[model samples]
Target: MPFDEPSQIPRPPRRVAPDDRPVADRLADIRARIDKAATIARRAPAAVTLIAVSKTHPAAAIEPLLTAGQRDFGENRVAEAQEKWPALRERFPDTRLHLIGQLQSNKARDAVALADAIHAVDRSSLVTALSRAMEQEDRRPDCFLQVNIGDEPQKGGCALPDLPALLAEARGADLPVAGLMCLPPAGLEAAPYFALLAKIARDHGLVGLSMGMSDDYETAVTLGATHVRVGSALFGARA
Candidate 1:
């Protein structure tokens, strides 16, 4: 059977073994799901970039996936990524690191120096900081303007009412605004939020839609996600 077919996507077994599968196997499983979702959406699988979120995972646990040929990785903290990725990248120099957490303005310089993509450009201060950092370092990582899709107060995304102005500020500062990122409120259906983000990206003529996580990535791909940030599914449950 063709692997990209919806029917070919693997389903959970009736009585599964423990989650002791190697990282390579997990990566393959996620890739197959992405392919299946893309095919169902009539999109080329290559259009979706799978970012294996490596936050809180030690380098030892991440190396197997690296050896398995996974290149795009995501991290949550600047200091943690600074500490672990330097040595890992020296060994595997092609790894693309994504800063997937809320970034403080003070760490903009470090983030610009470290990440190939910044997925949390939510505020004007961050936009100013990142623009200056990019000029000083002469490096421009792709940036995603995160949106608070569900109007959740606790999240680190630009409120919907303020997004246009924020996007304008980011553009005025010469930040490479690639697209939008969002985290839908937990325990709620994510498709609406994913669709909303995709529409917003289209309305603004932006191309990237960095949405989805381990549980909802398949849905995300079908809804036009260009990048899926999956962690637990790829690295296994963190202790």
Candidate 2:
């Protein structure tokens, strides 16, 4: 009888180990949810940017997420961010930090130094301060013009009608206006407001749209959000 040929070797499927589960697992879970949401919107998952909101959460929490390949983090309070950024930066040098809080004119200098981008430039005074601070520090921080989409008196954005003038002033002062940010009214549909901000940004030739949060980021992404600030969803409920 003729000698039988040796059988070809069989390859085993790769397995994800338990020790490698935390970060990648968390990221995969979040990405899956985002994908489902995008499908509902009839858009690609890449259309939305998930900005892991790390405000109030310590560096301990942030490290795990970073290890899982998360590069973008958002902080709401300038003071808190200022205190946390140095250590975080030292640890994760490549991470991008965003200041998603209400920025004050007084904190412009420090904010410029700490944040890769500031998402709350809503007033002429604040813009002027930021411009001066950037000149003084010789560093121009990327910024967005926050619009009071809901026009709620208690909110911290410029009124809808005032955005044009504010944009003009920011441009005049040499402020780098990257895009627009907004907080939609609570208990109401946010899509309209998000759409309005998107329109305004497009009209001004701006690109970034930072909107939505833990509760409604999917909707924001559907509405063409370039950046979504998600805190509670990633970090668990706020304490």
Candidate 3:
């Protein structure tokens, strides 16, 4: 994807889940589960980074979690994050923003400037754009190469066959390739996928494994996930 010409990536339609809860209680429950999973795996409780996915929620919805001491949050779209995070960060400067959705090469600059880590870097053109963006913006965020572990056609990750070359491309461009990221095929037992992603990262000498979400984060933790993105479980349903 050498200079494929950047274009705007449309945001997906919003789908809200039902109900909500006190962020503190929900956050506490999620952390307790994470700690239990980590202990079971003989991994340190501190080894996992819990990323609260706050994509469609409002600033007010997020404030409680911030006050509750969650430092890392994830957004699915760059535009939404740009609009939301600045004011939030103005109030709480220590928060780290993560871009956890399919990113367009066009938004690479904005993502580079805003995110502390990008969890979806799958193509060469995105690699080029992000590398340039980091240089021009004078900010380099950690990157994770998204692998379509289940090889789903409608998903955002790079196909398994393309990963090695893509990794090389990302590194050659001086993108700080932190590790691999993936989304298992939905509605399936996700353990195999998580294990596969961990193996891929291990094979590459990459330590970060950005897998797991509200439903299967514990399984992901058992498989060596360094980061778990939990949303509904932390914020109740979406609302």
TM-score of each: 0.92, 0.85, 0.91
Query: How many pairs of residues collide in model 1?
Result: 0
What does candidate 3 score on TM?
A: 0.91
User: lDDT of model 2 at residue 72?
Assistant: 88
Ranking of all predicted structures according to TM-score, beginning with the best and ending with the worst: 1, 3, 2
Q: Per-residue lDDT tens digits of candidate 2, residues 1-239? A: 11222233332442222333465575767678778887888888887778899999988888888888888899988888877778878878998889998988999999887788999999988988999999888888788999888768999999877888999999899888889999987667666777777778878899889998877777788777888887766777665
How far is 20's C-alpha from truth in model 2 (Å)? 17
lDDT of each: 0.90, 0.81, 0.88
Better of 1 and 2 by lDDT: 1
Which RMSD values do the candidates have, in order?
Answer: 6.9, 15.7, 6.9
- Measured on C-alpha atoms, candidate 2 has an lDDT of 0.81
- Judged by whole-model lDDT over C-alpha atoms, candidate 3 comes out at 0.88
Query: Global lDDT for candidate 1?
Result: 0.90
Q: lDDT tens string, model 3, 1-239?
A: 21121123333343334546677977887899999999999999899999999999989989999999999999999999988999999999999999999999999999999999999998988999999999999999999999988777898889887888999998889999889999887656677778778877877789999999888888899889999998887776753
